[model samples]
Target: MNNQSKQPISPTAHGHRLVVETLNTHPNALRRLHSPGSAENELSELIVHTALHLDTVQKELVDRCTWAAQDLTRVATGTAAPNSLGVLQNSGLQIDLLAARRADAKAHLRSALAAYQRVTTIAKPQHAGPHPPLPSRTSPRTR
Candidate 1:
């Protein structure tokens, strides 16, 4: 047997796996395809979840920033109330905070994306040749 040394899993991934193992008491697709509780399958699910969560956070921040920007534009164009100085100030601050949050979310998303790519690479190992030999059918890429 080839005794391959495995790399250490990230803390985030490990914690996520713990939750999965605890909750995955039933026979799900992951269990059916990758045994009762495969660590790789659990990690894959965590990576996907983290990436999607970041996507959601980024979208929310963008929506909030857009609203704040619209408010500022209205104030600038004198369309808003004359006594809306407080609203203008609050809108600017709100935009700044939203931008900062979006930046942080982007950083986290990049990390999660990298982790996901690494896991995918490991799961589907690099093929020696450009195209792998098929059983009998021609490769779709060649068609």
Candidate 2:
């Protein structure tokens, strides 16, 4: 007979895993979206728009993570009888990496925003709404 505990996954944990996976896969696709002239065409423009939307969402999540870490640091150090701040101190490496990733996410979002704006400017559609344009040959322009 099996004796292992059949533990259920917490929704928070599941969501975290999903976010991590999405973040992992998005960078490559985002790079492709950023290729020159990608916004000139409709399909590439759509990909860029979708990638931009996804990037914005990812940045928001990364911001939340930074906030949570800040709160954790406070709880670990600000209390009268503070909890083990050692954990945070010991994991300094990971914390630093996370901070770097947060910054990287911000930079990526800025790039995506620029791409979306460029797509809108160059691929102007007849009707008003957010849609990607066709990929066309152009310079890598940014604000």
Q: CA RMSD for every model?
A: 15.0, 15.9
Please report how far candidate 1 places residue 103 from its true position, in Å: 2.2
For candidate 1, list the clashing residue pairs, or say none: none
> Model 1: how far is 14 from its true place, Å?
25
Q: How displaced is residue 124 in candidate 2, in Å?
A: 1.6
- Give the alpha carbon lDDT tens digit for every residue of 11-124 in model 1: 333323332343332212222334335655665555446544545555666667678777768868999854444765776787678667656755664565456446646878
Error of 2 at 73 (Å): 8.6
lDDT of 2 by residue, 21-55 (tens): 43333222434534465543444444444444445
Give candidate 2's TM-score.
Answer: 0.33
Model 1 CA deviation exceeding 4 Å by range: 1-36, 82-85, 124-143
**RMSD to native, candidate 2:** 15.9
Best by TM-score: 1
Q: How many backbone clashes does candidate 2 have?
A: 8
- TM-scores for all predictions: 0.48, 0.33
Residue 86, model 2: lDDT of 65
